[model samples]
Target: MTTTRTVNRAARIVLPGVVAGVLAASALAGSPAHAADEEVPGLHLVTLTGPGTSATPPVTGAPDAQAVLLARQDAVLETIGGPATAYRWTTALNGFAVELTADQVTALESNDDVAAIEANTVRPMAGHVDLSAVRFSRSSDPRASRGAGGSGVVIGFVDSGIAPDSPLFSEVRGLGETRAGFSGTCSPGEGWPASTCNRKVVGAGWWVEGFGPDRIRSSESLSALDVVGHGTQVASVAAGNSDVSVLMNGRTMTSFSGVAPQAKVAPYKACWAAPDPADDGCSTADLVSAIDQATADGVDVLNVAVAGPTTTDTVERALLGAAEADIVVVGAAGNGRSAFAAHASPWVTTVGAARGNTLRGRVSVVGGPAFTGASRSRRQLGPVALVLGADVAADGAPTEDARRCLPGSLDARQVAGRAVACLRGGIGRVDKSEAVALADGVAMVLVNDRPGALVDDFHTVPTVQLSVADGTRLTRWMKRHDRTTVRLAGVGIEKDASEAARWSAPGDDRASLLKPDVVALGEGVLGAVPDAWALFSGTSAASARASGVAALLRAKHGHWSASVVRSVLTTTARPLAGTSTLVQGAGRVRASLPRPGLALDIAPTRYRDALEDVSWEDLNVSSIIMRGGGTTTRRVTNLGTRAEYFSVSARGFVRHRVRTTPVALRLGPGESASVRITVTGGGNPSRFDDGWIVWRGARGSHTRIPVAISR
Candidate 1:
């Protein structure tokens, strides 16, 4: 059996920090000359060739097997003068994390016993749903009965931490009991106690060995209680109690519920808030340790909202092992909006964010055209004088600074009783509104300068945001006219109609199989956060919602393999119109949980081979990828009850033509069949093509496999 344990709190190590306080504390500790030899340049993770906790068939050896492994690991450390080990792993990985000098890292690299040594990297946190957006309606869907609110599944969240005191996680009357098979326990910390983990929140733990106390904020808890609020928001979106009232800035927005409302929550706090909020993130060492412990804890699903490299790393390896052990691993695509998507490993289901619905506020120029933009402001302000932010610059302040509405840069005389138009950038969006409020401005109009997700952040004053194009026109109109006035119409909820967030990172070019398996509702999602509710956005939130979907499927079909669950989700997803496959992947995920007539399960051995190869278009997955033109074969098993006849068809290819052999297939119960598909390039000007290969069963079941071809 495996267990989760903490490093000794007494064995403190001084590390680099992000703020002046931490730097000052490090300076007072000692002199560099006196500790030159002991100075740690950075942290590195060293893996050993040994079996971990979830090794198949269990690792059987002599009675001194544990002792032998320890001695072998010590031999490597002894070469480095026995530096302190920050963390050790044997559950999901056989490795140790230690602060090493540059020379120590070089030595370990060439050691025979050590398998690999790599620098530990830090990852920043990267969400959610209104259930109706994903077809989760209790009134009509039959799959809703099977999901049963994911009662038997446990979803483990690797994020900042949870707020146990929030009503979102309260063990209300209808909440289900925590099921068996989980072996995790709650660790008591400064503000969080063991008793805080109830039927709803079954387990909680915190890791801080990698992130030192010097970096942690003074007001932050050394417990599972969240001060950053990111982790709590993620947990609440994935599995917190359902149908709870959502309030932002003390104003009731609506009732919010998690994707899998009744699922158990096991929070692993691998990330910590730094003294400088900008530097807050999760270290590789802490992330690996948390993933390992979650695997050993028998969690049914794992949600990784933190951003990581697109390529394989120690964290990716841990995710691989978790998937092999039948746990559904879901991770976020980075929010860079670049070509490289995060968590690109095949084992992890990478998710991108989609705009579901948002609260839109209107900015109407007096007797002129009106522009609608995303906002959370509910206050009503009327036809007031509008002044350009540059015109309100405080004496001696930069004109550009006033245009962005930086704090202490606006003059009260020019801004008072008028609506100030501030550009987006430099400071936080919420901070811009605060500056306007501080200057006694009645309202603020934010200008978006680029393409990205429009968030519904709580503002300090009645605020209405404008698009980039509209902002440009408004600014020009205000400058041309001597006196300008506009009316701030109130905010109201509006539907997004399945649009992908522009900020959601696109799939990388290198992967033979496409990354960002699917998109999910993530923009403007309201969830619990540190005794309150707030709106969340980004792929991080999308990954959490996808994890909840996995948990719901797991609870409904306990016998289905992880690969099958992934295949079903991929094949049954609904495509978003006018979205490229590179950005939206298969499409936005649906919680309807329809059973695909046919399912394909790729063996672990094949998975390894496919991943190593430069191109493996036929990886036996629900989705197909081709380079220009090629031919591949796919094997499918009949998952339906009786005999069925299916017809195959392809559509939506601009530069390629696809043909499948044996246009129709007849299969009986427990039968399997293979279909050979060929794609031929048409030599059109288009360099990329994406479409669907539909398998229509006579009984009215349609399975759509997404296909993408790149030149």
Candidate 2:
């Protein structure tokens, strides 16, 4: 189980004007001078008092700043007994990550120069995009032409390495010049070479420890390339050039395009291939090094497709530095099906997964309901004898195995001329279908084991998957009749509005702050693999799509601040139905050129020890209500040059009980205004209710602030 620190309501801090308030409150409350030593062992991040302001650390090469930080580092080493290898310096945070014993941490905390010490938390990889969904296509938004599909912008991927030779990264397709700000280089080692760096793929490097050169190879291929295929897929989703095509199932021709086709890419291979090709592992050391280099190289957008536990050490500090430098950083929300830690940092835009278009084979019972399922089989079968696997298990096979259609568990004689009905769970979906094929079954009917949404999967035989409820009925009917039959149709692609992927992680960090800032198309997203095309899923793909959108925004509005770019994407997102802010966040990211109407920018909450403390929440109105009512304020700044008229109205289930003061406002160009939102109890207090506070402008530009009310 993962442990988290709970912060009390008194510690809640609002943004814009709460900095001084929090400081005053802390001082008046007379908080303890020193925190009790948690005594947790492992690498710990030790922050020291720097000579500059908290918001901006001294420049990387400043002589005076370096001297002060070096002195502080020596003092920490003296107390912790480090031979320099015991810790690593993160110049951006003026801190060092050192492996220390509990006693050493206690001793270091006592040092006058040491500001804070936190255990280096482990972050797991969180494991993309449709350009049309985000208005990146030329047909959807004319502004796409203005940026030349995000030319001149550099997007850096800090995950698995990319396939350097993929046609998607060809410079002839208009991959523009490398930005002058980037100074990173391609360090050739093992199977990787300097030629991997090109005009389109501007930089390539890897950082791994403990594992020697031989262990660096991906599980699938022997080289520094993306043997896991994830890096290649994600990188292509973000910035691959146009006219890409995939020969699906070896026959279907499917054309593919990235969100920002003209953006430059920098591959920073920070993760190492795990024994299992499906899972890639990354260390805090390699990740931080990659981030430091990516930032120094001046990448405009950083797309991290990995997730892990929230850490106050190396990862957070590097991300903070990137944010301070105005880089739009995107990360995954994990695949754990719950709120995750690594993507909890406020400085990063945490993305969740949503459904995209998929190809599936339609299945229908002779006298039952039809269902949609995925299968790679091209054959169409009709009115075949369908027998449940449980009814024909081999005498010596385990009953559970028979039900799951495990290999060698079924009686071949009984299943040879019939279609097998297999229960889901206990094994891979594809494996089950393969087992049926091994048993000589004519077709397979896979039943979902649980409720909620279902993702399509490839199968070895003609197969159709049904929902749990539907599958239960079918099984009962088959048992009673003993002569059930079904039909399987040819495969076809199915497209629908994006829905939150069931596997995407949920959020409300330890501090009750909303995470997964947005959701995007990630399920079954087709993108480049080393020399071919394959469909990839996970929050990693969604984050890449978001990073690509950020690149497009940056290329078009080169003058906009990173915060503004984030604001535009979040505020303008299309909210998914039947999902909450915790699941979908600000909603699916959308992109468009700046318009003349109301464009609002709300600042994020600032904390005194933000980099060292991992307990801060983003500055939105998502709050828990203890009393019958609670009030929060937000400052909205207009970026348009003309006076904009807007009306504020609360919409959604909880809206009826919530009211905003000053329901109307007219602001001049570059003007700022404030509004107070009060939520009152009118429904069940035990249940959570959510709604949006929408500021609709007269000119059709809409901005929203999500509000959550809970007891």
Candidate 3:
């Protein structure tokens, strides 16, 4: 590559504040420069690794050169230092090797020298969330109790088409559009499929001709519909308005709501519509075309709750173009904690997850022969709870058993004071906690899963998570240790960054922005499914809700740019770290719209408030020179007639930047008054020369003028 091209690539720099926040935390994994081991003693300046190590090792044929096999992974990138170089892939080389270009690596893959390939999605965000809903929520206001408008907006759910009869989508089109046999064809999460996923679906695509002339297509040429119920779940969450009397959990529930219930759904068959879950590859070209189709159809939003390797920069530019056209894009975060993903393009709002923090808990345990001493052995040395199958077991979800409230409702008087035992099925760990909080005796919620062994159950009570085997054993041992199943209570916080589901991607992208965003109440979330009202979890559901919120925001703020949406979210979002780190850009997002009466807009600066400064929840004292026994105070001249409402928030500078508590205030037009601020709760700020106070109006736009707390 020419130095000019390289310079241009680096020069086209536009890093969002959030990205900057994360990049600041990104310690060079090794080095940005290439230094031979001889030059940097003890340091191995070596060229290693390649992309797409799916089935076998990728072979590279570099004759007459010292070839060194580096680690293996998907996504190949190279950095050159003088004559020395570095590679970002794994290969089998008998001798040391020099760095090469991405195209070089691709060419190597085609050669016979390659041994294994790279499969992205290996990063982990352990104990994290699902990002599906994260990006959407971040795009909109998570706090808005009511939506502004959702009609006319279109979110192309590129998964399965909606079930034509789904009550949840009563207000939507393409409901209950299903095809037969779209399931169980995906490689068992272990296959080298380019993008292997579990939740498949079925449906017809107007986007793709079905049987007409030139309509017939094959797996290589067609997008699969929803093979599993995932697409429906995502679509419903984004726009479900359920038909008939709301029947949720076997009862007449309220009408199900989505992030954008009124938004039109443009179903794109990215997958097959039957159990033959078409192993359709989502190549760069195909994704770009889909974006084009959505744009042409005037899709206001697009929900892509998918996980794939970072090999497709082709679609990224398209995503940027979509944003330019005012389309809101949302996707899943991931499940694992150890992995990282930096795919949150500045133009695209990336999402994460957070589980249902409501008050319902469950513990599913099987009795009878399943728990008998004879069965105990089988249960103990058991079937790995590889995946929860719509059940309440630990290793797996409860089949028909996962429920919110038992058929024979527990008497409030009887169970109010006692803890509840609703198994960890339908009722999510967090929500169950809230539910038990309601029952008088439901002192605590104990969750016991079925007897499998792989996956571990999560809880929100004095929460005890167990393997399927232990969970099964606990059923018979219930009387002991208060139902040897153990108690589950609460995990203190809840945000819509469901990081649990998104962690499915393969190789580590080495980018926190590319990894799982957060977690949500997926295991069992009470929502309107296709045929009936059911519960489901995954990054996909979260992504839907997030998209819905974005729709609301887009509707509310016509002409609001994507950056503005992202700005509002990251700026107003709660900082997650005790100190600002590279990983958690902003703290958990307030997935609702800003309150109508409060407005906050401020950037970090050095100054002091005089009115005791109590309302300023967080600030840097070093920056603010507190004069005398004065309090932290701000003078505001009301610019609006009558009274103007706004909220005050300040952030501390430096690492651990802390935002001050919002001091509610009303300013009369032409009135100049001093407002006191305080330090409520948030991360600490140690990086600023001074802390700052900001004004956010009810309109949710910040009067981001920095107010310094003085010494």
lDDT by residue for model 3 over 1-711, one digit each (tens)?
A: 001001111112211111100100000110011111001111111212221111122257633121233322222222222333222212111111233344454454453333222211111111112111111100111222133246555566655445534544433342222212121122111111324221111212322221111323332223333324556667776665523344323333234466555555655544333222222222222333445445434456677665332322323434544554445666554333333332433344455543344332223342312221100011111111111212222223233442333322344443433444445444444455444444433333233444421122221223334444644455435434332222232222222343232222222222212122322233334444434444445445555766776666665665554434444444444433332222233334455753322122222111112111212223211112221113454344443446777776765443223344336666665455555654332233322233345667665545432222212
Instruction: Candidate 3: list runs displaced more than 4 Å.
Output: 1-148, 171-225, 242-250, 253-255, 273-285, 309-312, 358-523, 528-530, 574-584, 595-711
Off by over 4 Å in 1: 1-40, 59-84, 100-113, 127-148, 248-251, 359-366, 375-463, 468-498, 604-618, 668-670, 684-686
For each candidate in the order shown, give its overall lDDT on alpha carbons. Answer: 0.72, 0.64, 0.36
Global fold similarity of model 3 (TM-score) = 0.46
lDDT of 1 by residue, 302-397 (tens): 998876555455676677668766788898886655335677666778888777766789888886768888776776778899998999999999
Ranking by TM-score: 1, 2, 3
Kindly give the number of clashing pairs for every candidate.
1, 11, 271
Residue 382 shift from truth in candidate 1, angstroms? 6.7
TM-score of each: 0.79, 0.74, 0.46
lDDT of 2 by residue, 26-127 (tens): 111111011111122365556565422223545776666556667767866886676454334443455665666767866765676765565533233444
Which run of 10 residues does model 1 get worst, by summed lDDT?
A: 19-28
C-alpha lDDT (0 to 100) for residue 620 of candidate 2: 34
Q: In order, what is each prediction's RMSD in angstroms?
A: 9.2, 9.6, 17.6
Best-performing candidate as measured by TM-score: 1
